[model samples]
Target: MLHPRITRVALGASVCVALAACGGGGGGSSTAVGGNSPPATSNAQITGKAIDGYLSGATVCFDNGQGACDLSQPTTTTDANGNYTLKVSGDATGKQIDVLVTPTTVDRSNPSGAPFTTTFTLSAIVSGATQNVTPLTTMVVAQMNAGKSQDQATQAVQNLVGSSVDPGADYIANGDSNTTGVAADMVGHLEALYGNGPVSWTLVQATMNAYAAVGNVEGVQQSDVNTQLSNMALSQPIAATAALADSLYAVDGDLIQESSTGAVVSPGLSPVRENWTLSGSTLSITQEVQSSGAWSAASPVGSYDGWFSGNFIQNTAGLGAMLMKTDGTWTNWFPNSQLHPAYALSSVGNNLVGTDPNTGDAITASYRTIDVSGQPLSTALQIDYRNPVRGSMSGTFPTGTTAYLASTQHANDQLMLTESGIGTAQSGSWSASYSPGTGVYWSSLSDPTQTLTSVQQVVGTQIQVDGPCLLLHIEAGGVAQIVESGASGCNYANEPISFPVAGSWSVYPRNPNVITISLPKSVGGATVPITDTIKNTINAGGSLVVALVNGVLLSGYMLPASSVSTVQQFPATVTDTIAAAMRAAATNIGETQNP
Candidate 1:
């Protein structure tokens, strides 16, 4: 003869009773009536027991009959005896109902077990208002007979959030509050794994928003939200697990610790230490992991466990659609998305991430992981000087002192030269030297060796250089005090200048005898007499007319003298007579012209 095993399973609100109900009741079973008659009352009680391998926390829900109904969301904690009572109102008449007892604290699908859901078809209620229910046999077990661990569950949550696919309506509807809270906690782990990227503010702000939304329906208080956000700044991963455990025990202790092998799950699901502090939007992590297991002096890692002080609004503006794969390949949904541009990678424990300096939104820190392997070496650098020219100018300046730079688009071996003020011809030579401690180059004016010295520098719009003697043009501002002139004194006169044609002309006064005329494409090779109106005196020099044919400078006598009188020779081609006179006079024409 075989024996029947009878064990007690807790059910109801402090109501534990022994049942002889039958799934396959063999020995000492209660007497049953073998009839198909329906019970009197439509409102009947259906109670059962669920057995599982591990049960740190569990919740039962009634689907189909009561829709998405779970006892956990609507009620408080189950007693220490693991017993719960749900006052469900339903018409129990030939309807199949699913009694789902999901493990609230563990992930079921990770170990590849059949999903835990139990169903029981109820006939008509035939008992009194209250009836004795018995064991409805249904058990949940993991695949490969594996036990679910807290860290595995946490990792699963992280992977889910980090995935591009949506959590699905079922996961969101069922897992919501607890799951999102878990996601917030998992961000810390990601921070540990991947330091804050340039888009950390968007990631963190989205996380905070999701957590807050989850809290709204779960009756989580604003105070709790405040505390959790504050703690996250100190590298504490969000404890959605602990929050679920709220119905169990108070988990207000440490859950994460720095290990040599990298960030590992502590004994429980709380932070390992809370020694970190946040002040004025700055997060300071004083905890050190001395073990080289996870990271060394060369390769350090960080956690997303802390708050990255940054502007969330500006960051969010740059985040359109985002795609993150389980394999950690992430890309923006839109090609135009731009986040906090000033973020850089940093580490916490064994994770690498980036930090954003918040300038628009509230003083807050945002962080994300840095994919270093996918990153390039030379990204971008600040342009020291923009548009350096040969004259006076200014622009968005750098730090330290006002800088004046010679244009980079200059002749080779030339240096940036400048004066205290204009007119006196004060100038100096400049070479490229990096700022002593910054990314600026300090050009030296006195050093002839051209050796550069690092110093904090400012960018100037114009830098001019004077070698030996330079031609000075007197403009509206000041008079030129010609210094160290090697040539004879320059005679200044308001002589009118004229253009023979609309083309470009270069005036090279060879002993003041002639000026060269460069004709435009239209005037080139044309036989028309070139006439010019003199607006100013011709600086005591004669002029020559030269033609450019087919883009080539052709030497010609386009305006030759008439071989008559010197003064009245072919004024029709004004400069032609000048050139012919200079060619004819053995005594240079520069001696005769004084206009």
Candidate 2:
């Protein structure tokens, strides 16, 4: 079991408060009035400026650390030039005290938006002496940049001043003019106070380290001078690996699957599902076969067991491996030990990219972990692309019109074909079996027919035909249900014209043996249904039938299951004879329509 790693990057700015202060104000020499007794009174004048200039009307309060500020005269406001003076008597006199200045409003022009108060300690003084308080503007701006937020930065400044680490007021005051120098100077001040004590890096180093840890060097670089400072302490490999591991664990499971579609491997091939297994440093992968719809278990199609070195996972055998960077991008040539071809990959959040080793084509995919309850059950699979053998035919109908047909067959004994150029588009379906040794083929076509009376009464349309047509219904479970009816063709001026018939079929679960098919005939945007019933045939096998009525016929044969897998192993081919026949019939229809 892998345990999550805790990185030092988790430490926040507030935690730095435990370190010493970074501001000024030290105790002075004391004079004994009566044998080491402190002075009874001390006088000090405090003055400061806002970011723009003088901070007038700002409140300055004195706390002796005992919460004893004269409330009646507890605070004094700065004048127009940001100058303020306070007279200290009582317990505050001759004792080190904290002076807090709360600005009435911050300088809106300052980018940092630091609107909090500034605090500084007043050195113990005798009567008639003055202590210059650092300007609030410089203190606030430096704190804001260090902590990256107004509130946190203000607190940091207070902590610095309270600890007596003097951040040079003059340098801070001119910070906007020479930001680089001022920032460096402020960092030096913080380092002097907290550097050797508990917090090691200066504020500058800590901020840069944080950004660099997350592959955000661009952010640090934008700060200009901090770029050089950050590079000294930047360590992303260790942190990035921990982060990547955490992300991988969140979506890890016993098995994962991804559905993909592209021409990277084969043209017009059906979609495939790729399975993956990730265990510690090892990874295994396999693909589900299209025909069987089952995963191969003998061995993984590929496997790679590696260890993370730097920002990458290199194979222990040193044949090939993958390179992963802190920015969530990767490139690899794993499992293909030859490493003749290379591929690039990126993993951002949930996206994945790669390339095929053999073809050198781009491969894109996405994945999700599968939740398994127990041994998975297998069910009947749907028909899919295997060997598509195309076929076509052309012929003249009794109604004195030409017809054309085109068809293709897939695995699982399924067939689909289309016949166009008739009054309406026509389609055909079949199940088939073929033998290359004897050049013998057997196929079945379903032809369902509608009664002429039902067509006129129920469908509310008139059709011309000499006699009844054989109606074949292909039902669920491969059952062929026949409805004895008449031929279908359009009537024009009492003359028969060949036309295509269209219909839909449905079966009820309660009585699956019975199938009901409906054909709608449209008249002036309104439709009438021609419905019929047929019984399902049971396992009708190995025989071709062509039932003719009024010079129209439907032909084909039932297919066996054993040949399905064999068909999938071969490439698709079209029957030249069948294709020629369909082309000739289409040509006839074109001649008639165009003429």
Which candidate's TM-score is highest? Answer: 2
lDDT of 1 by residue, 241-328 (tens): 2211111110011112222222343422211111122232233332222121221111122221211111111111111212222222
User: What would the per-residue lDDT of candidate 2 be over residues 294-341, giving only the tens digit for each residue?
Assistant: 223212221121111110111112223222222212232233233222
User: What lDDT would candidate 1 get against the real structure?
Assistant: 0.21
Q: Report the C-alpha displacement of residue 476, candidate 2, in angstroms.
A: 76
Pairing residues by index, what is the TM-score of model 1? 0.17
Clashes of 1: 58
